[model samples]
Target: MTDDAPRNSGTELQTDWFDTIRINTPAVERRAASLPSRRSLKKEWQAAWLLNAVRCMDLTTLSGDDTEDRVARLCAKARQPIAPDLLDAMGVSGLTTGAVCVYPTMVAAAKRALRGTDIPVASVATGFPAGLMPLNLRLAEIEYARDQGADEIDIVITRAHVLQADWPALYDELRAMRQACGPARMKAILATGDLKSLENVARASHVAMQAGADWIKTSTGKEGVNATLTVSLVMCRAIRDHHDRTGIAVGFKPAGGLKTAKDAIAWQVLMREELGRDWLRPARFRIGASSLLGDLERQISHHVTGRYAAAHRLTMA
Candidate 1:
């Protein structure tokens, strides 16, 4: 799906949509655990899935020490994620990451570096990693990132609202952030690890979708636990439910701690099993990780050459 595709135009604050929802923790955990063990792709099939994961990746750099030079290099990686020789070996061409995610201050640098490409620059706004800032300032930060040429704005939601069960407040804040985003797509990061329960994750996901979040992300990558399969399953079910009711597909992004080629394939399997092939595209699904690309490169190289290369052989993400 492209940016031109119709977006989720959100509904009013309807507490009935999720007020009575209750999560079965053990069942969710059992299903999430069974996913990886049930399916395994091999050889060419594995390579193809990894390549798709590459196309759906949010190649990211969100560090306090991030600089323009680093953002430029990251954008360069996004443009040509796989080495030419490897891509040729796999019979793949025009392969690039879904987007290059960076801090709000680095959006311009990313845009300049990714010039002349279809890749979108996604910026984490609204006090990312921790959305504890005042609401006005957080909304201003969204506008700032949008003005800086961010094609997508990843806004972190205040976990307190979910903890306190203030569904109306959460919906109102997200709606304001969505308006502030203007033309840029808004991704509401629920930071599930801090929400304290699977039920909270499900309810938060519903609220975010109802408030016009183009995507519901699992984490900000700074939490103690980020993007667990169990948590992701709950979120995906909520997405499925939202689509069932509204006939609109909201995207899902699982960020933080997703490393290795196996991790890449596992999440894709989860998406395929839960949301079908349409959600496998970049428009509906994104895996947020920095080192994941490097590992994917290594695995692809091994697939083509039948030998593993040194980790240093691949370009740094």
Candidate 2:
């Protein structure tokens, strides 16, 4: 329940922060390509690792059709995460996802539903999926989400800024967004799928951290591609490098296209090997997924009963 992340101060923009950045595309791709075979578990070990992934998951509902009723149900699922009987059989207690993520408008509904628990409600703000809104409006959106009781604000950065190599503009915008978030932790989404190169991804990661982002996220889940392993390698390495130089830890979230229990473990491995065991915790790492939980529960059920359960056997998460 405790976190090692410190509050980020939106200090004056740092120039020359991205001066020494270099990303070897082929090397990153090679490591990412070999990632799947590198880590594999079965039975008890697989179940245990999936449980850890559940603890670090951000159970999310970001559809346009999301409603208060749906948000309530989602919060209920977040509170329990897995079936009580399954958890009991496994000898686990107090296991929950890292948080529930939703649109800014649903923050209050999520907050009300998650009341009386430590589970935080995270809202995607700053023109989510596309950070093309005016800077003023994006800043206002952060404050609006905060006032509505969002404990965390996921802000998407402008891809154009990175494409143009405009580090100063990106730094100023992220710093301002961090300030706007106030007490709510700020998660800067790089939207790496649109950033076009590993080098751009690394530079954007550094800018986000320097601008006081508590976490650096991979995507908005709306891009053509989201949360690829090669991109994750680039971003996680940036997180490690930042911590090494500045002595500040930044969280990492790989959202979108992560559905299987295997995908969860792959990301878990990436964090553990690249960032260390400390980053494996909910505070430092989160799998931003909704359907992923269903697969995890299904796998856990098989582990417990020695048989696979039909998808319908588990409630829709």
Q: How close is candidate 2 to the true structure, as a TM-score?
A: 0.97
**Highest lDDT: which candidate?**
1
Provide the lowest-lDDT 10-residue window in model 2: 8-17
lDDT of 2 by residue, 29-120 (tens): 99998887787687788888899999999999999999999999999999998889999998999998899999999999999999999998
Q: Mind giving the per-residue lDDT tens digits that candidate 1 earns over 111-158? A: 999889999999999888888899999999999999999999999999
Per-model CA lDDT versus the true structure: 0.92, 0.90
> What's the lDDT of the predicted structure labeled candidate 1?
0.92
RMSD of 1: 0.9
Where in model 2 is the C-alpha error above 4 Å? Answer: 1-4, 10-12
